[model samples]
Target: MFERFTKPARAAVVQSQVEARRLGHDRIDDSHLLLGVLAQEAGVGARVLTELGVGLDAARDAVAALHAPDAQALGALGIDLDEVRRKAEAAFGEGALERRFARRRGFFRRSTGHIAFTRPAKAALEDALRQALTLRHNYIGTEHLVLGLLTGGSSTAGRVLHRLGVRVDAAELRRRVLDELGRAA
Candidate 1:
């Protein structure tokens, strides 16, 4: 999954994990993943979210709303938050001990390493990269990344983007990308 990510994208995942640890979060959630995606600063996913006015706080709020105990909030949301946490730990390594040390020292860990990503986010990134490869794109485009985010299926990010009016129809986005590339050429 990590192999498909651009260096910046990978860094963003790492950055999110580190940020979560600094915040004393035990699990890497979708909110953390969205923040990490934003931290990348140069991906289509980030740009699309930003253009749709989806800020980090807004994304966090959206996630929190869905996290309610009410099962009726979303029918068949189908995400195992615990599994997501485990995947994050596997991908980015556990930070519980490191975070504790930083807290004790009255310092925050801002150094970037292999920070974890929530499972949905990881799946989204991987799917997006796979789509890009299928299309024979030399570089992963923002649209590709956005589509990847969508592929995670019923995610906080997907729901929030829909509510914010960011449409990500794969064919349309791909056409736009091709058009832009053609114009550039």
Candidate 2:
């Protein structure tokens, strides 16, 4: 499948790993893949998403927000995360919040220095190939990757796209993709 990927597609996959590592994620998820795709400013996928008002910065913010603690929700109730953390640390000693939120170091920890792909991410890549085949394209490009991310319903990337008001339904995304392809051609 990788052998058929165009240069931009390969770059996006590689960039996903870099983004995952930079974000302190042990594994690359759909959000990381989307970030990778958006990083390619000249890629067809990036251009299409940009046209939809979902540029790199917007996508990055969405992914970062997903990782962020639900502080805003608490803030709505007049609770301050920082204030609660300060109180907890004062009573329980330093690093109280870190200890509380930290998971046990085991399976979730990276066994190797290399970041691994999450199941949904792998599925998206495979789906990219399927997308290319479905379109009767010889090469798997970034556009196919975008399609995969949109159609891979269980993925974080798909959820983000949906949240961003991009149509993620199969028919709608396909139509938009074909329109983009027609324009590019």
Candidate 3:
């Protein structure tokens, strides 16, 4: 299946891993996949999403906002999240929490080479293949990936898109993609 990916598609996949790592995630999820597609500024997927007002930086900020600690919820437990972060950073320097997991134990040891995909992410990839097949395409491209992310119901990407004000459904996004393809052709 990977062999069927075009260069753009493969780059998106790689970019997803880079996003996951940047966000300190143990696995890549649909949100990361969305980021991957959006990172491709020239890809049809990115162009369609941008037209819908979802750009890469904004999407990344949304994803980070979603994963950030719930200060309001923590307040109910009498915890001051901001104070804790400030104190921790002051005590150990900035990015102290991040350094804990990212630190290398030995001179030769480093972070793992691979980060696995979450179930939903794997499902999205599977759906990308299905999308390509549905479109009668010989290979999976970045556009198919965007379609898969949109159709992966209740996915993190869906939530991120919602936050980014992308109200279009999968069908709508698909139409836009086709239109873009037609223009390119």
Candidate 4:
């Protein structure tokens, strides 16, 4: 399922798997993949996601919704929830978030053919993943990616978010969700 990815995209997938394992997770969920992409810091997908308002917490919510069990009381609704998830996954894969940044960065490299993400971008991606895991989310989504871009701060993605007016506060959103869950419980 992952063969269509380029070298950097493949790296993102590998990074996502590593992150999932580090977090003791067993599956390569979308959120984990999102985190993996962001880990590259300079990938086209991460930059595009950051440009959008999506962040780690919002991504978590979306993924959590996907993970939520179907309501037994909604039997009459007759909705194919699995199909919905599959569609969402397909959409995510087709989006700009799945592209590699390595090719983009390669344009500026010296003759040695060595290029790396700026430090801030790398940190931003790591922070995004940490924030997502801290919230106990099983999958990485667009939001986490946005948060990583913001946290990575001062990159093209971060600048794009500022231009788009997306807030970069993952913790606040997490707290609010927890509060809501507490109330529901």
Best by TM-score: 3
Residue-by-residue lDDT tens digits, candidate 4, 45-96: 5555544455544543444444346755344587665565568678765433
Residue 2 shift from truth in candidate 2, angstroms? 1.1
Please, what are the lDDT tens digits per residue for candidate 1 over residues 1-185?
A: 45656776667667667656655555565556666677665666566567657776666555555544554433458766556557877877885323432232777655444445567766776777787887787556555665666655587666766666667665665565455546545
| Displacement of the residue 112 alpha carbon in candidate 3, Å | 3.0
Predictions ranked by TM-score, top down?
A: 3, 2, 1, 4
Q: Which portions of model 3 miss their true places by more than 4 Å?
A: 86-94, 100-110
Query: In candidate 4, residue 57 scores what lDDT?
Result: 47
For each candidate, the alpha-carbon lDDT, in order, equals: 0.62, 0.82, 0.89, 0.50
Global lDDT for candidate 3?
0.89
Clashing pairs in 3: none
Give the better candidate number (1 or 2) by lDDT.
2
For each candidate, give its TM-score against the true structure.
0.55, 0.77, 0.88, 0.32
After superposition, the stretches of candidate 1 with alpha carbons farther than 4 Å from their true spots are 1-4, 19-25, 29-31, 68-118, 138-143, 165-168, 173-185
Query: Which whole-number lDDT from 0 to 100 does residue 173 have in model 1?
Result: 54
Query: What is candidate 3's lDDT per residue for 1-185, written digit by digit as tens?
Result: 99999888899999999998898886799999999999988888888888899989999999988887899999999999889989999998998666424344655333577888999999999999999999999999889999998886899999999998889877888899999889878
TM-score for candidate 1, please give it: 0.55
* Candidate 3 positional error at 100, Å: 6.0
Distance from true position, residue 132, model 3, in Å?
A: 0.4
